[model samples]
Target: MMHEHIEALRQRFLHSGDDADLPIVDAHHHFWDLERNYHPWLRDVPRIPFRYGDYEAICHDFLPDDYFARAGNHRIVKTVMMEGEWDPRDPTGEARWATALHQRTGLPSAMAAQIWLDRDDVTDVLAAYRDLPLVRSVRHKPATVPRAAHRRDFSAPGSMRSEGWRRGYALLEASGLMFELQAPWWHFEEAAELARDFPRTRIVVNHTGLPADRSDEALAAWRRALDALARHPNVWLKISGIGEQGAAWSVARNGPVVRDAIACFGTARCLFASNFPVDSLVVTLDDLFTGFKTIVAGCTREERLALFYDNACALYRI
Candidate 1:
């Protein structure tokens, strides 16, 4: 039934002649080999607490073929690979693997490599990433983010407020790379501070600040944080991962979040991404994208093109 519904939705978008053939540069996604690499979250005995609940279904190797198969009707010309949590011992290992994967697959035109900002070897890791041609940015999810409470606390060892993390973050400009920040809305003010301190480096917030709570008050708080962060011209937003726990993805639930994000960041500073494999736990590729297209169906063709294609290319240099 869900597949039938998705097909119907896909047909609606395909029939919308204005932007049906719009080329897409999937701003974010992932490919992993559980056999070759040690992803602690996926391979560990106890699964780490995930936003999408139990994700055992995706525990196997997810290579390029898997991604291509799930891409469905969307004409995904290019993609930006987000770093999966690979072995932390050798931080540059993921980038090397992705570079090799791209050589064979010719997908993931760019990559956001993993780098622990607070690690002692961060300087060397950043240097290694700079040498990898596919690496366009790096991700280091800050420590000590408040989950249940919306309170601000940046004193944790690897939090964005930490001196060591800031030192590593400051080097991104010199390395010619940007940053991928994955934190909840409550942390955006701290992120805004990080953005202010290092004005030269670009920071792209992951998962729309993880707006998981869709309550009226929660959304208002998310919007306030977005407003604060958007004030910093260096910050950008990705409209993906809006799925709710234990619920199917639909336009009715996610459309407002998408539209609000674009309104906050504007089309130029906003990009559309699948956050695939991770988001696939809640939504299929076709249905997820169909929701994106349908929600913005009333917008101008140029605006739609910017969200779906142009912005990603420019932001990631894909």
Candidate 2:
């Protein structure tokens, strides 16, 4: 009987055109007006080619209108805007800007601002973010990818295990902000340790442990990381950014990764996201969500609801 239900849902999910009727709370995505905000990576594109070369297509001002236009075919009820790397000197500037956009446009239902946790004024920064009604979480994306992987390591030597970073992480629960962590699989054990030590703190692991290498050895490491982190009830996974893993954007290619991740974390722990603009470098918004819907076709409608909206609402408190 359960197998019959699963197959029925799969049939509906596959045949459904656009799936535009379903409500979506985009757990991750970004909104940036490049002219007003400063993104170092976006600005420095010419000199340093990002991992996926020749990204001239997405080099533009992507605002709320642009996002909704891109999302015309889907019922995106809400979005949690991940902090764009606004100028680092005034760390809270990005959140403030995003808050104002939320007030004016009503697009971003909530926000996750970026903070340099190791800095001295971190508490003051977190406090200001807390003042904004829309701010629900914080992200401090340090480089966990080893230089041996031929990627730049911007994080301090210890990554999540660094003393100062831990000190700052301790403050999030009290401040009403969850931590949004973006790191490679190598740092998952450290992330698991962080989750255990600060069980009070809610952490959302970004980009599905960023299985960027995708070799059999790399996939094994990524799975180990996901498995370890899923042990903590407080730790949740935002399943997006598979596009950056060097695979072509297609349901056929991405299905295995998505299916395995959901199996690992379960529907209750998984949050669906577009990772737009950043992910737009690889595929269009429509293609991304459509592919995602197809990949999870076997899930029951209730499970699909949790994946698309309910889980995001609970995790980010949206």
TM-score of each: 0.93, 0.89
Best by TM-score: 1
lDDT of 2 by residue, 115-213 (tens): 988889998998787688788888988646562653222345446767888788888878978899887767777888889999989889888887777
Worst 10 residues of 1 by lDDT: 2-11
As a TM-score, model 2 comes out at: 0.89
lDDT of 1 at 62: 86
lDDT tens digits, residue span 1-318, model 1: 633553454354455645557677788898899988999998997888887899998888988889878877776777899999988997899999999998998877999999998788988998887689899999999975555754565467788888898888888999989999998888887898989988999999999999999999989989988988999999999998889889999998888998899889988899889998889899999888888989988887667877887788888986
| Candidate 2 stretches greater than 4 Å from native | 1-18, 45-49, 147-158, 245-247
Cα lDDT listed for each candidate: 0.85, 0.80
Error of 2 at 207 (Å): 0.7
lDDT of 1 at 49: 88
